[model samples]
Target: MESSAPPSPELRLDNLRSLKVLGKGGMGTVFLVHDALADPSARSPFALKVLDKSSINSHHTNLDADRRARWEIQVLARLCHPFLPSLLGTVESDQLLGWAVPYCPGGDLHVLLHRQVDRVFSPPVIRFYLAEILCALDHLHSIGIAYRDLKPENVLIQQSGHVTLTDFDLSHKLKPKSIRTAISSAPAQDNFPETRSKNRRNLTRWFPAASENKKGLKKAKSARVSPVSRRKLSFSNGEKSNSFVGTEEYVAPEVVRGDGHEFAVDWWALGILAYEMLYGTTPFKGSNRKETFRNVLLKTPEFIGKRTVLTDLIERLLEKDPTKRLGYVRGACEIREHEFFRGVRWDLLTEVVRPPFIPPREDGGDLTASGKDIADYLCSLKSPPPFPASPSSEYQRNVSYGEF
Candidate 1:
């Protein structure tokens, strides 16, 4: 049976006095909401992400989508980091179902990148931001969760210059042993086999099958032949499956090959994001999806033109071979001590400070607006912000890349 559509403003549960649009994508819409219960002096604006129940019902099986949403909420509830958005509350009304998270007035990294398109971030600034992200990822992994989706849109910066990671719908608790086993069993073409195995094993564990054990194992082995096939496996156990979960340009080769992927996928994305921040565009981009996949699979990223210590750091992180990538082999501490981040004081990063870039604030400003406001803000000025238009404008203008 189909569920009812979400509630309109008048029918919403909480007393949201003011709302401003933050952004919109394939998932749904995000709004900055003024929570009546919050102290006005505290600046406690919350982000309300409304899942389009009707859209999910039309495009996907409701139960699976609902479970994914709930799982995201659960993950958010359990996590608390200085650089992580705090989950305020969850609302499940007959008309609408969504969760409320702390609103960051500065918006996401994608917006920041556009605002500073021609400009290059100083090494210290880049190190500061990247370190904070790494710290967040370390915390998530330490707690057994794998943040499968990592991109500029999923990262938010506050007006105070603090960075936080958000959007937990695609994340999952990692089982290292299972992941290791799967990676070890995977073929050579697949580099990050650990991540893929963990996801498949988790699916099998959570949604036990009634099929014969031997058949299930055979089916699992056959599914490992291609990335698309493995993605289908992820969705089969009554879960919402995303064919291409991460941004195409930033996806790791292992993920593209379906050999096996693991937490290292996040690091690869970080490398891409870091490169974009310093150079104004991704190092590797293709004219088409197939070309892009091929580039990821077989091509080495070109770091042509001038070089900096940061360039070498990004190249290390973007390495196609997971075993050679930073953190995977040498670990995070070693990566932190590299020449690119030589002057960085890791302990100081955690302290609240202003970010290097921020959107212009207005008098009597309401950062917590509806989804429309967010979309308008993103597309209003430049739409595509002129970042190496090798691909089509539609691909370039999409700031969130359908992940959020």
Candidate 2:
């Protein structure tokens, strides 16, 4: 599903223009950019994720954060799949680290889900999207990479409306080793149930899939889920992580318990994603972070309507025990064989003439629109303020495209 290829040396920061800010996070910013040079100018606009070396050096988990940023670039460098991203180029300076990849104009599944009737997709739509997502995850696993984060927000739609998984910062490399270590990722405040729900409330929250305009549902600022760490991580062939990571609602029971987890956690999150796609909200949501963890550990997903293959799929995925979860034993191989995906032409997903949803062209799709200098934004983040100006600030990808 993927091949490791070196990035081109010709693509660099100076020739690239940051047209607009696509998204932002604690680690970096994603910008919609196009190459000013003739070669890149021929292609459409792509995304650049810039990480400030200054920012990476300031965090308590600075080592972990730096590793993740580099690892994500490394992951992109090797990826060559229709449902995944490929490295356009990379940049590294004394103060900045960045990389570029194709930009998906269709936004993310979170926004797409909200645009649907009653804020949920039809079964056919869900199946189409899920199939593509599953393929993306399967490809990642095949390369010994586990996609620990599998929320709707991370599923971005291409211009063709097919899905591609983003945000590899939380992804883990799989190693078939049984050895266990005492290593834990990050602090307990971001993972444990003992963390007060009040302070935890503001962090990347599990928003109920609902429209803020529909019923006065209050939509808070979007939060980015943190990563959980473990000394040894693997899946299918028997590898596990003791680290607690993932969104509150989507976190698997094993992860919550700090028990060893692996590729099964991705399946559990997939079940949650499918559930949200079917129903308007996730099945295990609670009033607070503590309650959410409790529900993940103890709650059974409540399903409406009569039994069906789809519901069955979600149930099997939501199994409290990771070992019992669908796709646990065989990875995505088993899940693809399930009845819900019966008749799906898994191999031809990318070749399908018309995907369920194709994004219409917009003004932002134009590559040459005069944009602000990337250096202006890059320099602004070189030195962070004494405190964060706001939870949500804009940023983009960075670095020099040298030999991979």
- Using TM-score, give the best candidate's number: 2
Which model scores highest in lDDT? 2
Off by over 4 Å in 2: 1-10, 39-43, 55-62, 176-237, 363-369, 380-404
Write candidate 2's Cα lDDT for 1-404 as tens digits. Answer: 13445754536667778776776776677777777774444257778887766655456667666787888887877776778887888877777677888888777787766655466765556667777787777767766777888998888877766788988887777763233221211112223334343433210121112121233323222232224554444444556667667888888888887767777788899999998887768878888999989989888887765666677889999999877888766677788778767666553444453455667655554545555557667775444332122112111211111100
Count of residue pairs whose backbone atoms collide, per candidate: 23, 15
Over 4 Å off, model 1: 1-14, 37-43, 117-119, 177-227, 231-244, 352-354, 358-404
Which lDDT tens digits does candidate 1 get at residues 247-333? 788888877866556667777888888877665566567788888889888887665455556677888898898767876643455
Cα lDDT computed for each candidate against the true fold:
0.57, 0.67
Residue 306 of model 1, lDDT score: 53
Per-prediction TM-score to the true structure, in the order listed: 0.69, 0.77
